[model samples]
Target: MSGPGDVLDLIRERRAFTRGDVLEITGMSRMTVATRIDALLEAGLIIESGTEKVAAGRPSRRLEFNTGHAFVIAANVDTTHTTVALTDLAGRVAAEERIEVAVADGPDVTLNAIADRAKHLLADGRIGREDVAAIALSIPGPVDPDTDRPSQPPIMPGWDAYPIPDHLKAALDVPVLVSNDADAAALGEQRVAHPGSRALCFIKVSSGIGTGIVLGGKAYRGTDGGAGDIGHVKIAGHGDLLCQCGARGCLAAAASGRAVARALVDLGKPTASASDVGVYLADGDPDAARLTQAAGRVIGEVVATMVSLLNPSEVVLGGVLASPPLLAGVRETLYPRSLPRATRHLSISQSTLGEKATAVGLAAMVVEREYSASAVNAALARS
Candidate 1:
């Protein structure tokens, strides 16, 4: 690891630290630590916040990271809406706005809208466009992380094999990272709500249902990037309803927000979209609650398998329809179906971060990518 990068990491983890603390923890020579500190300060990546009071001798100055040294753009795209935000290096959102655009509009139209909105948000924040260190995007589909491209996304048509990173990089003139929304939500929820969680699963039930897995504080996207894609899991008896993936009896077709909306329409409630269903739920519509509860039970059938397979410590329910019925349905089915050993310590609950989970997750991923030891070293050396 680069000395300056390690020093910066220590400061970030500890929030504030003295040169002596860095030297001791890093086991670096005094001269090495001093040189690293000087390099970081010269690069404007850190600030001398204040001195720590000492009982004896002279007080030592504590170093703190300069979170505003650069900014990152984070975008969270779902089936019916997109959110773009400007965040500091520490992933704290400085400005954010939501755009009501349908993902069915295709990648060209949607990604362009996101890029344009990000520019406007940066303008509103009065941050120079050139100061953007990176951009992170969270989409409602499985992403091939190796290539940062959507891969056979059932809900997101015209996005398959789309070079999202290259497209966004062309528009924003910075490197871009892309991930599935469920994966992003998992990371965001785990970091904020369950920081101590070693095995966590975030379930998103919107136009589609997906799961994000995290273990040991890091994402566990299986090889080829389709690990937690529980949406396509087939149900034994429900072969009547067709899924967006061109398959029958898929969990999404039976249990997603769209599924319940379709159910509501069957009962003459006639919701055009999941967002409309959310409105019905907000207004305490009993039919919506009942269908949602049934949807949850269907999803719970799939989640039971996941709990047994991964034995996650936490199962977070999120998305537009993460309401009472869904939460209750998941808990009701998950508790009884899952093995006793797996359910012993598992905590299933609705997401506390709600709609902001994707944005928070995207920002965190960007920060981690931009502030890795090698990335920091490379950045300072170029500077």
Candidate 2:
């Protein structure tokens, strides 16, 4: 019975393994291993794959976790849009949709819209409501990691201490988990792109500026889940500038994607949201590219300090400003401003996974939460 968790862990960690391998790794008798495998099979957590030929005796059946056993509902909400997706237990997205909505419209309106989109995505993926294991969400503000609720979010009006899990749970009828957008983005990048990195940092330059840190393959969310809120750090030169957090000369007020968009609009170009800046840059708009790079320079000034403090091996520039201009601006400042020893081996680049990063991270987190040792034990008891 105790071998179930061990067997599952081995299979998940190694991708595929045989019954004999699990027995050997767990040091459990053959009968106990067989019984544990049966229990996992009954719970639909794992499946037996084709047999592997041993060097000597009978062929052993290889076991792997059933990724399609259940579905996870994930949502990545930003200031101007929301992405909803249905993913398998392995964080593979089946179907996804992006809804144009505003985060400033209050959580009730935005969360309800997201719930409707999620239900439709589930149907599109051909997964039933009862098949949902959990729901996960990431927003463009600080979140209390312990409680999965918003925490005094400066830009998100009427969202402080909102019961995000309760609202989504009422609509979706499953456990809901929430985190800050930057944290989820970093975790996704770490899991998929740089799995072996010891220290990684993701700077999210969306409607605002924030950072997410991953140390040793885990998110380093500090006490009260406010570890990476770097947007409010004041800059010396921009004394008269006011930030959305009611602070003067804040980094976000000077260098965020939103700031760039506002600047473009003031320059007689039509720009609505931070995502619009990305669209314009992608279209090779010279003005957009130039201003975006300038903003990146301002952002890089702050990131250089972070590089000195953290000495992360990789720094991923993500969200709407993940472009050549941003990357170049960051490199321009980070290399010259940071300590030579700290940045000798540092690599900085744009986000590869794009908008799907948060959705995938949410699915991976929900799967991990649902299948931990204690959760597995409780599930077996219920079975």
Candidate 3:
């Protein structure tokens, strides 16, 4: 039987819809459509806009998804910094803050800091705790789907299987969701910038390299959540350079921002992390541009294989090192190596959302889960 949840699914997918449109689309009786719409309106899940003119009858009221009825708390945790945001159900940021908290500080300390900051953000926005629907976080590591914990992350020490969702849920008393940073950013880029692309790939060239895949408007987190851990893929002829995972000849060891930073430090540059390397690139440092471009070529060598396999419509470069030099370098190698058919529709570009991509994506993830049809139906049943 048609219910409020079913009607909502249709309305949310469209910009604005009318009862007639719903009837035609769902093939439901006028009474059923009216009843479901009325229920959704009463629940504040949807709102009536002005009106849409009809061919035969009087103008019908236009209905839209209510974006302001609830909010989400979203955060992105990197190696040396974290960003927290309060966003509406549509993933629009209301307020945000950045903190220099290290992920290496262990899950407890870092998560506590994030929780405190989140509370402050809510208080500042004058939003009540009950209004927050969920909390979502993106971390620079692989997360176990079943356990909702970091799964043997190479850079995040002491975070392996650390019960992240439970800790945050306990602190805030809200449902918590966790994601891989690259995966979240890929969703952000696809949802915000390339909504038409059915298949998209996002390569994050940060302290370490990672890949994110989005297929059919959904993130493709592989079984066990280890799908996009491309940084550990070995590159031939670099066995001398050891990776943080204790593996030699890894792609990240040879061509990631961390590797470029090490090279700069060896060349008497005062750079430490990938973020510092970004500053150097922004300053137009010749050495930084050169090394980053070279790194891009190396990364492209690996991405070429991904392009052939996935044949994504778009490939976005993100994270700290997503710049012109990197983009050019990837183009240099990716175009030649990938097959003509694979590269035909591919559009490679730098990130449009920049540092805020992960947070925005996390918010979208929360909204999609919390407001899904089954969830809405369950909530309506309880009400």
Best of the candidates, lDDT: 3
- For 1-383, candidate 3 gives per-residue lDDT tens digits of 44688788888867338888898888888888888888899999999999889898889999998989788888889888888888987778888888889998989889998899888987765788889988888999998878778988988989999998889988998889999999999988888899888999999999999988999988888898898789999988898999988889999999999999999999999988999999999999999999999999999999999999999999999988999999999999999999999999899999989967776678778867888888888899899
Off by over 4 Å in 3: 52-60
Model 3 per-residue lDDT at 186: 92
CA-lDDT, candidates in order: 0.85, 0.85, 0.89
lDDT for predicted candidate 1 compared with the true structure? 0.85
Per-residue lDDT of model 2, residues 123-220, tens digit only: 65457777998888888888987888888888899999999999998998988989888988898898899988899999999889989898887788
The list of candidate 1 runs beyond 4 A from truth reads 13-21, 47-64
Using all chains and alpha carbons, the TM-scores for the candidates as numbered come to 0.91, 0.91, 0.95
lDDT of 1 by residue, 1-383 (tens): 45588778788666338887886787888889889999999988889977898667789987887878888788888787888888876567878888988889999999999999987877665677678878888888888878989888887888999999888889888889998889988998987899889999999888888999998878888887888999999997789989988989998888888888898999988799888888999999999999899889989988999999999999999987999888998888888898999999999899998966776677678767788777888878787
User: What does the lDDT come to for candidate 2?
Assistant: 0.85
lDDT score, candidate 2, position 269? 90
Which 10 successive residues of model 3 have the least lDDT summed? Answer: 7-16
Best by TM-score: 3
